[model samples]
Target: MSAPTYIYKLVSFSSPVPDPLPEKLPLSELDVASGFIHMSTPLQVPRTLKRFFAEDPRIYILRVKYSTVEKNIKWEDSKGEVPGEVGAEGMFAHIYNRGLGTTEIESVAIWERNRDWDEPLKKAESWLVY
Candidate 1:
């Protein structure tokens, strides 16, 4: 028998907004929960590959990055913090759908494998996402 193979998948989500916004819109509490469900996976790889190749596969590392602007409010006047009134206005508009806010999602997956299985499987799993 040959050494096992490894596979990895990553997925990310962001708020709906455009560039130039100080920050991406905050995800609703519900949206955060939904995002996890959006990242489900089903086992479909052939048994020859999954059972023999993936069993005891090497450990892999994955990382995901997401960015969005957050509304900040403070009593004291500060350049960094958004004014309370403006924050309130934007929040109200966001809730009412006056416009959509924006966020950016990025993800990466990394793993080390025996040279024999590295090239082909890496290419195949490169674009895999949940």
Candidate 2:
């Protein structure tokens, strides 16, 4: 399959992955509890961070392609995606598979709260990969 342009994963220091990165990273406890791996687009990161990652000291953003997850990824409408609505359109991308690895990740950068957190990733393609 052709790789997706990009998808985003939010991570903290404790977020699971092995040193030097891994070919396959394990899902977090939160992922198992929710039954899907939650990922955001550039359009969704601001709200995602506010709702799920508020006030966190460090947030790492990882860019990945859909080909890495296409076998088990699903695009579904979110129930509360638009508020006061029962079902929304293609509002979220979820991983139906098991885990993701560093090889699947294209680029990664540290998002410090002091920097452009105001815009909070205006565009998924805007970050400088390190």
Clash numbers, per candidate: 7, 0
The true-structure Cα RMSD of candidate 1 reads: 17.8
User: lDDT values of the candidates?
Assistant: 0.27, 0.63
Report the C-alpha lDDT of model 2 over 1-130, residue by residue, as the tens digit: 2234677888865563345777777777777787888776656667777777777766877777756676776665543133221112346667775677776788676665654367545443356321
Residue pairs clashing in model 2 are: none
Task: Please report the TM-score between candidate 2 and the true structure.
Answer: 0.72
**Regions more than 4 Å wrong, model 2:** 1-4, 16-19, 78-90, 119-125, 128-130
What local lDDT score does residue 47 receive in model 2, on the 0 to 100 scale? 72
Off by over 4 Å in 1: 1-15, 20-24, 32-63, 66-104, 107-130
Quote each prediction's TM-score. Answer: 0.17, 0.72
Best by lDDT: 2
* Model 1 steric clash pairs: 5-53, 16-101, 17-101, 17-102, 23-69, 24-68, 24-69
